[model samples]
Target: MAWTKYQLFLAGLMLTTGSLNTLSAKWADTFSAEGCHGDKEHEFSHPFVQAVGMFLGEFSCLLVFHLLLCHDRRRPVPTVNPGQSFNPLLFLAPAMCDMTATSIMYVALSMTSASSFQMLRGAVIIFTGLLSVAFLGRRLKPSQWAGILITILGLIVVGMADFINLSGREEHRLSDIITGDLLIIMAQVIVAVQMVLEEKFVYKHDVHPLKAVGTEGLFGFTVLSLLLIPFYFIPVGEFTGNPRNVLEDALDAFCQIGQKPLIMLALLGNTVSIAFFNFAGISVTKEISATTRMVLDSLRTLVIWAVSLAVGWEQFMGLQVLGFLVLLSGTALYNGLHRPLLARIPCCAAWVLDDAEEQASAAERERLLANNRVVQAGDDA
Candidate 1:
């Protein structure tokens, strides 16, 4: 039996999605193995590694942008005037927000567990929804609001599970974990703001998404690099050569990356993955509706969590699974039902009305031309 076009398309999407997921996993593994987590002996612990990784990742993203621009040039170039080149500064906003958000998330990850990170990240969807409405003047429907509420509830469940687990652990400090959790939540808010801003200014301008991403990466790296120079100047005793602590050991180990083949591989993997994620994400947006893409993205998080648990990178708990289910359900509800229902209102209606108006205008023009010819014929007679 021959497959329908839709079926064929679905098959292709599945393959692409699977490959992207595998690539993401490989990248994460490489970083974990290469001590991208940094060494226990170094003073540069979680925050430092995160900062450095983000720097490298952004640089890699810029390279990918260059590749994308070259590819675009081979196609019919868009009619851009000489002064119409994308302003690098305007593109920097999203990149700066992303770097800040990701950096905070990384710092939080060091303080918390993988499961907590995944669960907490769900808050981003809610923030994105609200930010879209506030910043972009996009209105959300009641159903979307319902979906957001469900997602929030699910995340709360996940957080509760983390709290329970923490209570059972003698080595963990509750205060530190709470602080990290708050930081992660803040990061999600930042990410949401960044996404909304990108949609409004960058994507709306018909900027090639990859080029925009690349510029963001370039600016992010530049900003971080400058900040790090001042950071290096801060008398962090470990850099002063008193190698007695974990932070010192981590810093020392980072210095050894120049000699480690594995570290290089990990860094390369991370960079490649960053590029792939951005490219795939942008392409997917063009192929699928944002609501659908957001739903799939939530599913991807679940897949990541499952894989992490299976690989012993994370410990699975009943509550964690329940939380994941809740979060997933909420996401589905929002995308599948809420968004579609709400779209029927002012936005979709306005689009249809505009299209009808354009058709009417064309018909009127034809009618006027016909009447003009009729009048001319009468004059000749």
Candidate 2:
């Protein structure tokens, strides 16, 4: 009935990460939309700034994690033989992928409601499954296929609902809303690609989770820095069409921060949260299972939705609610959550869980028998 300290620590990390992640979206959208630094409006719209912040934050977190590891006597898995375990050159792919995905998502956040932005990410599970089959030659169970279908349905429902809402609005641009939603979806696909590649290569390479992320963060930060050179010359939004000088928009954002103390605070919070989100995410994956991490990610979506509503950024929509339920159901089924629950139910126990249970039991029995034979051979010797 009692949890170990380690368990409590993990739970705390998850809670902190989830809350910070949800609040990051809220703060970002709020400061961008509601004005920053005491002004009634944001002087300039710059999701690029968030993109910049991401690399910096991730890099910062990486430093802290590396330092903590150094203080410990235990050797890191990937650090035992750095050249053998991890090649710095191999970090390029995921780093590029991270930059692309992070940039797109931040821009999308400015365009869509936090709830929709979060909900659209549910597409990642479906994408990951398809990617695994195509590249890894992995086969799926029947229930997993069913879950994929359900998840696809949920994606359609949510997209359609957003479209309907967009069409009903006079001021909203159909192109912008659709584009934004598409960007978010596209980012999920990239993320899925990154995950699959990491799973295949990084794990085989024995790259420690934190090390891989830190390396990627370093690469991503450098790349983003280079990209910002060109972006700095771009005009700030559509206001005066003046070309943005180096740090022009960031300067404006900071000046606005001077006016609104809370905006500055929120900005700081967003920076820290983004870092913690990455750290906690990796921890969850390593400590628990990847499937559990996926479930926790969905829980984070719920937090974003609730916070969005509480803060009056979004209204409850029946279609959105239905779509969320479908998404949740699909994720559960894909992750095999339903099997245990179905087995507990009296009627469906035989229908749904029996086959899976039988297969698991058979495989376990075979393993034990093999071990017994090995023991008997040793005794005979």
Candidate 3:
């Protein structure tokens, strides 16, 4: 089917907002804000605080959700299913998972280049697949398994490039980048758990996607916001840019934001971009195929990398480009998008067409049964 202009707009919104989410957060880290001591400016190193900003952004989703809900109530037909209601408290578990994953990712972003941070998020595909099989009793197709392996290889290549510091940039230590990469991968594990939880527990209630995001945001923000107090008192060796040298100095972060207009702007961008990104992403999945959303995500990664390089945030590395291509191919194959395109090539046409024909035979039946469940429950995964 030909794409509509609105679909194109949502795709662009997804790409732009998703890219900005990472770039703004990374950009925030580039600033030096005034510390509590007032003696000198300190580098912005508050990952926990950043997580709060992200959750706050997510909470804004609730506002739009309610506005839409009110509009829906005025319609002749009600959109909600009475029997599908779920307790709001169930979201806490996934909210915690989101909190942990987002915090670790922020910390990892601070230690690594923005491009690598964006690229490494692809790790979630691997973990989500594995976790779904283990916990959700779902089975992966052969192509999907192949995609997982190829994605792993791509991750290794990316990690190796960072490990070797192929660009030979001495600004960050080798360990920091490696640790950052490891942290990002670890965070994906938690993210996978969150996705599975959402699929199993939340989706069963037939919750609206916007309302779910907003609820999770509310839970995550409220809990993490409270934790910031203790984090301020807990001393930590790393991220010690405040007078107390604690894990996260909320006061110092606030002071820094007050002192540096750019940091505030970055945080504002981070918040606003996240809300819009999630909105655009969900809308894209609804209006188009999830495959389209994945493609847009890959494009977003490229946009982020180009921006990072243009801003001198990181040097260009050839291996990273190769790894991204491999990863992109893996995702495309997993989604069965490559079959149609590959069938055009004379050398591989026979094999690709055979697979395409096989899948097409069952496509209608599977689509009928799985359309609502998969699209509603698994898109975020």
Candidate 4:
């Protein structure tokens, strides 16, 4: 059956959303525990597993793209033709940016609490908005700006609550927490830059988004794998020399994988869901507007949060709930108040079609009137 773009989009959305929710529920407990207590010793023993999971996630994304390409092979997903030569240089900027951002995020998560990770990641929206305006020359209406501010405020409120809970807790090291938060924020900034650069590249070169993603993933995995190689070889004596301790740490790291089947399932589910969600989102954007897609994406985040809370990965703290509502409200306002106003301005084919339809109807009436005149003249004659 021939599928309308909307149908394809909805299918992608369902697949992505379901997988993501399942992944989130599974990973919540594992990430919560590991994010709180994971250390270098535990990391060293099971280095391969860590590397494997990272590799698998990237490979999985690539696999999804390949599947998409195969399904749509009759017509290539739109992309720039590199003219029969592979350009490694073309991949460098995006790959480096992604690698840097992802590496920092992973390291940061290891240092901070999962709750902090969730709350702080919201800052990405703010960074993305600012980057769009500055780098991409996109203008944001005042209401859209307000929405960004509201999201930031909501994150601040959530962070403050986390801070209060951590206050006077000697077990929770303040410096480490701050370091992790800083790393996460830096990652967000890098990601914002990466997204902007990616858009420019795709539009300027007419690069197919899927192909671009595949190339970016390949480069990212290569770069990260290379960089991590040194870490794997670090002498155990330098960090903690006791052979037993080293062996124990390695066992513990391996145990981390086995300890939480549910969390692993959640992580895996999230990976699959994101792949499908992105494909659907791209399809929808082709049919609709990016602003519309962004609105939907925000709604998806709320869905994730709701599911996370419902599954008990997170407690329904009053402030956290309030923050989530505020964030969501901001997104709604941006969509309802700002985007509709922008859409009214004459621009794309969709608007042009409306104007054309009006002109066509008027022309048809004029033709009928002229025809009637000819008939009347014949009668008089």
Indicate the TM-score of model 3: 0.88
In terms of lDDT, the poorest run of 10 residues in model 3 is 164-173
Q: Per-residue lDDT of 74-125 in model 4, one digit per residue for the tens?
A: 5646452332334546767977787777656655655555555655666776
- By lDDT, the best candidate is 3
Candidate 4 global CA lDDT score: 0.58
Please state the error at residue 322 of candidate 4 in Å. Answer: 2.5
Show where candidate 1 strays beyond 4 Å: 1-46, 58-62, 68-84, 171-174, 233-253, 256-261, 288-292, 337-381
Residue pairs in collision within model 4:
23-266, 26-263, 45-250, 78-208, 79-208, 80-207
lDDT accuracy of residue 229 in candidate 3? 88
How far does residue 354 in candidate 1 sit from its true spot (Å)?
A: 16
lDDT of model 4 at position 268: 61
State which candidate, 1 or 2, has the greater lDDT. 2
Residue 272, candidate 2: C-alpha displacement in angstroms? 1.4
| Evaluation by TM-score, superior candidate among 1 and 4 | 1
Q: Which candidate is the best by TM-score?
A: 3
> Per-residue lDDT for 34-63 in model 2, tens only?
333444554334565667666777778668
Q: Is candidate 1 or candidate 3 better by lDDT?
A: 3
What lDDT score belongs to each candidate, Candidate 1 first? 0.63, 0.73, 0.88, 0.58
Candidate 4, superposed: residue stretches over 4 Å from native: 1-88, 110-116, 132-134, 137-139, 168-180, 234-267, 287-289, 329-381
